[model samples]
Every structure is written in C-alpha cells, then in structure tokens.
Target chain A: MITFYEDALCENCYAVRLLLHMLAVPYTSHFIELYPSRANLQPRFRAINPLAELPVIDDDGVIIAGAAPILVYLAAKHAPGTWYATDTPALAQVTHFLTLAERLSATVGAARRHESGFAPTDLPAAHTGATRLLRGLDAHLWFAEQQGNAWLLPTPHPTIADLACFPHVILCEEGGISRQPYPALRRWCDRVKRLPNFLVMPGVFLTAPPKTE
Target chain B: MPDPTTANLWHPIAACADTPVGTPQRTTLLDTPITYTLHGEGHATAASSSMLPVLIRYGYIWTSLGTPTADLFDIPEYAEPDRRRFNAASVSVHVSAPRAVENFLDMSHFPFVHTGILGAEPHTEVKEYDVETSAERDEVLATRCRFFQPQPSTAADQGAEVEYVYRVPHPNCAILYKSSVIDETRRDVIGIFVQPVSQERVRAHMLVCVLDDRSDDETIKRFQQTVFGQDKPILENQFPKRLPLDPRAESPVRADRVSIAYRRWLSAKGITYGVIPAA
Candidate 1:
C-alpha cells in the first residue's frame, strides 16, 4: 500500500494515477488543494516534499516525488508486463521520453498554470515550446503508425514513455495549444485512453473503444 | 462585435454541472466575459453591469446578448421517462460556433476522424440523404442519411448500417437523431449546442438522450466524449477558422447536401458574425 499526495486536476498527478490504476495498486489518497490557498506550499507538506509539488508518493517509508520518477519507480516495482522497458535501446528511449516529460511540464503545464492565473508565466513562450514538442511527437507517431507501431517507442507494449507524454499532450488545449493539427497524435491519445484501467481527470477526456472485430 | 442576428438568439454559456451552486464561474460568450453565480436552484445572477439575460434549460445555462424573439428549440425525446439524458463537459475549440455546428452535420469525416468506432476505411461512403429547409419552423433538416459504422454506440455489440437525421435549429446548434440499438423504433438524440466565444473560438456543449438499458451514465458519456474528442482537433484545424457562407467558398460533393443547405440557410438569415461573407 502507498500514500499518494495529489491535486485532483494536476496533469502530472493524473499520469501517476493512470499507472497506479493500470497496475491495480491500492493506495490512500491525500488530497492537496493547490489553488486559492496554495495548500501544497504549506510547511506541513514542505516537510514531506521540499519541492512542494504534487504527485508525491510514500511507498512504505520511502518517498518518491515528481511524475516521471514515480512512474518509473511504480512500473519497475508493480508492472509484471512491459510498462518500463529493460532492453538497452528501449530503455534509452524510455529515459529520453521521461526527460522530455519535464519539458512538457515546463511548457504546457506552465501555460495551464498561467491560464488559471496560478502564476505569472510567459504564455507565448510556453505555447511555442509546446507546439514544437507536439509537432515532433505527432510526426513521430504518424511514422510509427505507418510502420504498424502504436506506442511511443517501437515496442509491442506501451512503455512509460506513452504515459509520460499523454497527460501533457492531451491537456495541452487548456494551455491554448490545439491537438487538431496532429491527427496521428490524437489517435495515439485514443489508443492510450483505451488502455485497460486508463484513468481520467477533470480536464482529461475519454476516447471510444476500438472495434471488436 | 458579435453579429446582431446571432447575438439576438440564445446560446448556452455553460453546462449547469460545471457551475456548482454558490460558486461563481467565468466564461466568455459572443466575445464578452460572462460571470454568473448560482445562489438558489434555477436562479442565476451575473456579476457585471453589462450582464446578459440568463435562462436555464436542457441542463445548460443559456444567455443572450440581445433581445431573443424565440424560445430555445425543443427536443421532444428529452422528456421521455425511460431515456437517459446526460451532459458532457463543455469542450473549447479554436474554431467558430458555426464551424462546430457544420462539422456536427458532416458524416464524411467519421471514417478518418473517428476511425474504428463511428466508421472505418473501405466503408467510407455516405449514402444519399434528402435535405430540406422548413420555412414554417425556420430549420434545416436532412433525413434518410445512412453510414456504415464499426461500433455505432457504446451499447452496440457489432457493426451496423446506422440511420441518421440531422437538424440545424439554430445558427450555432445542431441536433442528431440516430437509430437506437436497444429500441429500433426510437432514435437517440445527440446535440451540439455551441457558444461563440469569439469570431474564431467556441465552447461546444454536448447533449445526449439515449434509450439504452445496458450502459451506465459514465459509459454513455465516455462514448459521446470519445466521438467529440476526435472531432475537436479537426474542428480546430479548419482553415479560415470562421465558416464561409459563400456557396463557392469551399467545394462540396453530393454528400454535403446538409452542410450546403445549412450554409445557404445561414446566409439567408443574415448571420454574419462567425462567417466569411460571399464574394
């Protein structure tokens, strides 16, 4: 069992919860309100996570913070399947996406914050950064689909790379970036959403199931 | 400024569910910031001096910038006792309100946009449909439309030839009546009530009333959202952003009768806010 600290609408927190639900791990939720009061910055929470950010998990006595690291830690421990890649090439790609997720958090995530008036951020720069990343990802997924690959990496099963990039990409519209130009990216999102036990937050929407035949 | 023709008509500003009681929710309608607080049931008051008139109907908070001469269009099936009516969260799109409504009337994009669910490759043909404008009711109607769908509804077990009838009762609103898998005699009503946030922006409010016994609220809402989710990107990516009213502004084939009728009707009605005028 784990104690999870999260904001209900946090994109990063949504990613961790998606993995948790996929892995069917039981956990107790500690809701941290991040708006109006900025409760996460309170001293009581600062003692647990110095960064004062959400999606921090306490697995027994060990504490893990941030979405990417927590996803890796949870997948390595709970996933009996191929969520986190072990092969050298695949692992490198997975690590690459995990690192890129930070950029997503900085750009798209920051834009959402700026839109919500949570913080004073450069909305234009954030939108530009997000557009560049989304275009790159969309082209990658388009070619991947041409080659009969579904996940981020050319693997049969989806790795943490898919989960890492999903929340940011899907929720980019809140930051003023539209997913409209990226058809392949939108399809990939549908694939991710249709994944077994895929979770949705307030802003994150659901996709229809694939054909049964 | 918002088009006077459209401004005079009522438009949904937000879903009732999105505006919890006692909390003020802010949203833009027709390029104007609208802030409303719900203190008591069915009673809403706006914050600003230029506040628009508010009306709650069909699970949404509708407002009008100018005087409205007509009531909100009726959906008779919504009153059915056995039917389940669900409201999907409001989706914001970069396209104009009319663009969103026009997309709702199109069946050609289902295969490419909503592939594997609403339609699929090789079954991409949209059969001939009849289009008519009812002068008496002032609405556009398209009937006898048929399309091949992989999974027509969440309650559907297999692919089937789905029957459809599309109606455009307002400039920014379109209603869909499709064949029901559970009750063949009845049709599931799905509507897109668009809020024109600006000349090139909209907030789409989805209304669904279905006669299904098996699926739960979450399942039905998810299916509808999934279909609309696929449309959101395409709607946003449309060039010009605003819908063109000229017949020759964009090429149309035999399948676009409904869309053509809709544009012509909009032109006839002098709705100029979210449209490019004919050359």
Candidate 2:
C-alpha cells in the first residue's frame, strides 16, 4: 500500500495519482490545500516532505518526494514492465520527458497558477515558454506517430513519460495555453486517457474510447 | 452577388491532425462561436449559432460563417506524391485578421522581426518585386521576390538565397511559395490561414508542403513554429490591432508593394470585418 500525498487541483500531484490508479495499486491519499491556506506548509505535512512540495508518496517505510520521482519509484517497484521499462534506452527517454514534465509544471503549470490566483508568475513569459514547449512536444509526437509509435518513447507500451506530460498539457487551457494548436499532443492525451484504469481529477475529463469496426 | 468577404471565403479554423476522433473542438470565427467534431466515416462537422459549411482540405478543417461563394483554394502540390506535408500549430495573436494578413505579406520585417534565421541585419534591402491582380483567379499575386536567410528551412543547415512568390486567393488567406533547400526546381508551399476571432484578435494556421524528403514532419513543424513564434510577439505588440486600409494611414515603401496590393484588394472587396476604414 502507498500513502499518496496530493492535491486535487495540482497537476503535479495529478500525474502521480494517474500512475497509481492505472497501476491499480492500493493507496490512501492525503489531500493538501495548495492555496488560500497552504496546508502543505503545516508542520505535520512538512515532516513527511521537508520541501513542502507535492506529491510525495510514502511506500511503507520509504518516502519519495515530487511527482516524477514518485512515478519512477512506484512504477519500478510495482508495474515495472508495463508502466516503467527496465531497459536503459527506454529508461533514458522516460527520464528525459520526466524532466520536461517538470519544466511544464514551471511554465504551463505556472501560467495556470497565475491565472487561477494560486501563485504569482510572469504571465507573458510563462505563456510564451509554455507555447514554445507545446509546439516542440507536438512536433515530437507528430514524428513519433509517423514512425508508428503512440506514446512519447519508441516503446510499444505507454510509459511514465506519457503520464508525466499528460496532465499539464491537457489542462493547459486553464492557463490560457490552448492545446488546439497541438493536434498530435491532443491525440496523445486521448490515448493516455483511454488506458485501462485511467482516472480523472478535477479540470481533467475522460475522452471517448476509441471506436471499433 | 454575395459579399465576397463574408459569403465566399473559407477560413481554416483547425487542423485535421488537431481534431481527433470523438472530441469536439471549439473556436470563434468572425465573433461567432463554432463547435467542430469528427464523426462517422471521418467526416468533420462544424456548427455555430447556426449551420456552417465545413470542408477538410490539405490537412485543415475549413468553415465559413456565411454561405461560401466558392470552394476552398486549390493546391495541386497536395496531390503530389513526392512532397511532404506538415500542419504546424496555430498561433493566436492579439491583432486583427487584416493586420495579420498584411504582416504575412510584408517581407521587410524578416530582418527586424525574424532576424538571424529569416534575415540578417546587413541584408535589409528589399529589391523590386512585381505585384498584379490575377483577374482569372480573382487573386493577388506577387512574384520575382528574393531574399537571403540564415536558415531557410529545417533541411537547410546553411544560409541560402530564397526565391519567393506570394499569393492571396481570399481576403483572409495568404500562401507563399519559396525555393526549397533540397530541390531548387521544386519550391516549398506554405499557406497562412487566418481566422478572425473578433475585431481585435486572430489565429493563424500554417500549412507547409515541401518536396524535400530529407527531414521528418517534426523538423519541418519546428522550423515553421520557430519562425512564427518569433513573429507572434511583434504582431501582438503592434500599435493598431485592426489594419488600416488607407494608404495615407501608414507610410508605404517599395518593400510594401505586396501589402499595398493586399490592402487595395481588401478595400475593393469591402472587407470591413477586421479593417479600419479610411478616414
């Protein structure tokens, strides 16, 4: 069992939540308030994650902070072959996109925070950076699809990279970054949503399942 | 005859690649809220407050707010087996459609607006180009234009002289055919489809069809995306959101011949949707 520290509105927490649900792993969520009154800053939560950042996961005695790290740790321990690949090349690609996901949190996620009054940010710069990243990601996915790869990495199966990038990119519109410009990314989001056991948080919705002939 | 500006034009609202199966995409065209969805047999249907005519062409979903007087613009290169096509992300600017169209028509901004990549500071000269109205097609054509670019396309790693031909088939559509880095005999075609959200905002959809097989779709998209990304800030920061039709409203130089012709054409067609009429 995993103790998942998360916020319903935080995209970072949502990333880890998505992975946990998809893996069908039993976990109890400790909901934290991010704004108005920062409950994560409370002494009790800070004892769990000194950084006061979400979403940290306590796997029995072992605790992990941040969404990417939690995703990597959980996938490696539980759903290895499926959610997380053991191969070095696939792992490297996953790590690369995980870093990109963090960047998205800072930019796209930051813009959303600014718009929703959760945090203060340079709105224009955040939006510009987010747009640039979206364009690049869209192009990458476009070529990936052209080569018959559905997810971010070249693997036949969806990996942590898809999960890591999914939430922020899908919910970027709340931050004034429209995903309409990125068709490939949007399609990739739909693919992620269609995965079995996929769950949605607030501001995220399920896409219709793919049709069968 | 129906109003050419309002009735006869097809505006690209979204890219086919962006509009996937089972989801509805919403956008505003001419201040009208539009909802588009892909249905059975891969048909794209668009609806607003009322019925809208929708057509999918060259990897884009085009719709008209009013009755379309003509079919979507023809691109023979779309059928060419040797060419590769890319649909870049749509860029939204806080400027009117006419201003956006005029910016697309102007080449002088390449050095200042798109410096280093599209042009250089030293090569600011705009050589003479010929612009005329193609009566048969009812389009404005600008030909024999040439410019130097540091990196013309993703396939080009070095600077090269690029030949250009600008075509405006509709009030809100502009296409540029420029020399390809891979094959000099074959030119790359880029179409800028502008959607007027309101009097002060527009979205530009870019379609690139090139004869080069060297680069992948991602590379082509990134190159175009970078170029347009550089242009967005300048377009958004421009003084007047709506383009002024009067020649005296803004100073025109030799390099603005295509822009002048476009303005004249828009004025003649009475496209007041996103234009500031002459005082």
Candidate 3:
C-alpha cells in the first residue's frame, strides 16, 4: 500500500491522484495543509520525503517526493502500460511538456514563492512579474490548442505533462485570476478534472500567508 | 448519496509496444504517453525508463491520442489570429479500473455532466440493469458480450469485415467499433487511466485515432480542443462523500454488469480506497 500526501485540492496533488487511479494502485491519503510546515515540508513528511510537496508518494518504505518524481517512479516501477513510453523519442516529447509546464503561469498551483516568503526569484519584482506569468500561461495554452493537440506532445492518460500543469492551472483562479475569459484554457482545465482521480485544487494551499481553514 | 470518487479504484498501467504512430494510435487497456503517426506505427518502447505509463484510480483510467476531423477552429472564443495552431489528439476521458468491472455507466452522463455533448435532458432517462456478478478485491465484475460496428468512414474500406470483442475490466470501457478482417487493426479507442492525487480528484487523458493523416491537421486540433475543453468546467462539480452501498434502491441495466464486475475485481485484488464491497 502507498501513502500519498495531498490536500483535497492542489492541481499538482490532483495530478498525482490522477496517476494513482490510472494505475489502479491502492493508496492512503494524508491531507497535509502545506502552510504550517517549517519549510513547507511537513515534519512527518520530512521523514517520508525530505521535500515538502503535497504529492509525495510513500510506497511501503520506498519514498518519493515531488509530483514529477512520484509520477515517473510509479510509471517505471509499479505501473506499466500506455502511460510510460518505452522509446526515447516518445519519452522526450513527454519530457518537453513537463519542462514547459514548469514555466507557465496559468498553471493552478504556482504561487509566488517570494510573495509567500518561500523562495527568492531571478525576477526583479513580483507585481508585474505576476501579470507576465499569467499572460505567458494563457498564451501557451492557446499555443497548445493552435498547434494541434498533438503538436506540443502526445501521451496516453495525463502523463507527467498534464500533471506538471494541473496544480497551478487549477488554482490560478484563486490568485485573483479567472480562466473564464480564456475560453480555451477554461476548457482545458475542465477536461483535465474529468480525468480519473482529478481533484480540485484550492488557492488557499498556496494562498498568501496561508489560511486558518 | 455516495461520492462518485469512492466508487472505484485504479492502478498504474504497464507500458505496451506497438503504439501506432503515423495514423493516430490508441493506448492499450490503460492510457498513457503513447502516440502514433499516419500508419499503425510510431516510435515507442514497452516500459522504457525514459518514461513509463502510470495508472491511477482503481484502474479505470488510460492515456490515448487522437487526430480530429479535418477542420481547424480552436473554438471561436480563443480569439487568437493564428490559424496554424493545433496538432493531433492525445487525451481520452474514460475512468474505469482494470479487471474490476464491466460496462462503464454512460447512461448517467447522458443526463448529467455530459448533457451538452449527448444532448440529453434532465430526469428523462433513468435506467436499471440486470447484472451477473464476479468478485475480487473491494471490486466486482459484471459483464455481457456483443458485436459492435465502427462508424464506417469514407476513408475506410467499405468491404472490410469487422467484429468487436468486449471484456470490460471495469466501467472504464467503450462500445468499440471493429473490422472483421482477420488482420484488422485497432484505433479510435477512448483510453481510461486514473491517477489518484487525492481521494477525490484524478487526472485522465483521452485520445482518438483518425485513419486519414491527409485530413487537415488544424481542423483536427480544434476538434480536440472543444472536446477536452468542454469536459473541464463540468467535472469541477464532483465532490466525493463517504457512504454505504445502496442495494435494490439503485436502478441498473445490463450495461451495469461491467461496472459491477470492475468493483469486484478491485476487491479481489484488495485494491481498496474509499468504496464499499460491491456485493
């Protein structure tokens, strides 16, 4: 049995959930609220996975942290099917999407680490930086739609690509951003949630100063 | 009412070889990162460390790719003047656990979440099913068999013989279209793969394969955008609640046999999460 650390929402956490369901791998949940942690990494979670990401997966004793690491690990070790491509080229395409998702602002869970006092960035300031980030996301999702759904890359199930973007994209609306105007983007989010294991991510997880509820 | 989230469980999918490339390929029982080009060919390996197919839910999720119809239009709302936007299809929306049940309950979606696509009205069609059962883990398997026909396309061989075989491991299955040719190829399948991030949410990828690579790629992209994009807003409404099983009071039909079977299968495997015994 595997133990997954996640809140009810959190697109990234949802992504991990999505992967678990597709694999039909049974797992227990630890709904870590992420804010009260000393370094964002919960105390017990630190023992299971040094990193404090909510989507950590504890496979019996073998622990993996981060959405990317946990997903890739399961695909490689536990589940074997359409999701993990065998060849290099096919896999490379998936990697490209994963890398790209990290940079997009429209993603559901990407909070300003600096604004939240989590991490510092190379950017000058976050006010304009935030705007730029959201626009960049809208453009990218548009680009995805324009470039043929297959243009960006192709993967069965949500793969790590969708997983990478799930959290930030899902929660972007909570950051005073609305996917409603970005019709295409809005649709993408909706489509993503419909996938098995797709949970809703709340902005409060990464909300400013965290929350009491 | 019980939460839909607790009704099923999913497992990580194993990678498969022969993921068609050239002419849009489909994923196996489980959907993941696999693509095909124009013909029944592409580049992919079974269980490559570079990337592997992961599973979620109890087993009712998969990854697939599709090439939409030849008409490029990223929904008129996307106001981007770029016509060259859009590529191919690589997402599917079926949620079922493998070997857990039979017949995905499409009837419910018709009147509920997917009403727009199905053009269904409210409370119009409530169905009940007569099901046979088999059990495993915290799941079950109810099944029935039938012959299916693929929507004959002009691009397809008119004289082609076809026969479809259905063995639903769970509710995450399709009424597939098949060709009777002894060496017939399979494509245009809606893959089901579930990844459980929490007890409630899962990320699913849906894909469709097209026979004609000659079809304009842009048109296909728009089609995919609309299909997947439409499903997003609706799914946001799902909220899982813990509840005991409702016996007899729940109406079902022959189609339900598959769903029941999948629940049994998961139980036999001890793949429990948040569901009651599918007795």
Alpha-carbon shift of residue B179 in model 1 (angstroms): 1.2
DockQ for all candidate structures vs. native: 0.11, 0.03, 0.02
**How would the candidate models be sorted by DockQ, starting from the highest?**
1, 2, 3
* Native contacts recovered, each model: 0.00, 0.00, 0.00
lDDT tens string, model 3, A1-213? 898777443456666777787678889876564321222353765766665555677788887776676777888776544566567886886676666555553222344332222233443343345456556656766777776662234444445666666566565543334556566656566666565544333232211222357
TM-score of the second chain in candidate 2: 0.95
**lDDT digits (tens) for residues A1-213 of candidate 2:** 788877666788888888888888899876665642466788999999899898898889799999888989989988898789888898888999999999999999998777544676999999989988999999999999999999999988899999999989977876778888899998998998899889765456567889999
B122-173: candidate 1 lDDT, tens digit per residue = 9989888999999999999999999999999988999999999999998899
Clashes of each: 1, 2, 166
Error of 2 at B28 (Å): 1.1
Q: Give me the displacement of residue B257 in model 2, in angstroms.
A: 0.6
How does each model score on lDDT? 0.84, 0.81, 0.42
Taking candidate 1, what TM-score does its chain B reach relative to the real chain B? 0.97
Give the runs in model 3 whose Cα sits over 4 Å from its true position.
A37-43, A78-81, A104-152, A155-157, A201-213, B1-279
User: Could you give candidate 2's per-residue lDDT for residues B1-279 as a string of tens digits?
Assistant: 224565557888877765556698677787778999876444788998777888888887788877777788788887888888757547666788878888888888888767677898898888999999876898999999999998888788899889999999888888999998888788889889887778887778888888766776645655665577556656766778788998899998889998888988888888777778776
Clashing pairs in 1: A180-B233
Give the Cα error of residue B118 in candidate 2, in Å: 1.1
User: Where does model 2 exceed 4 Å of error?
Assistant: A1-213, B1-4, B40-42
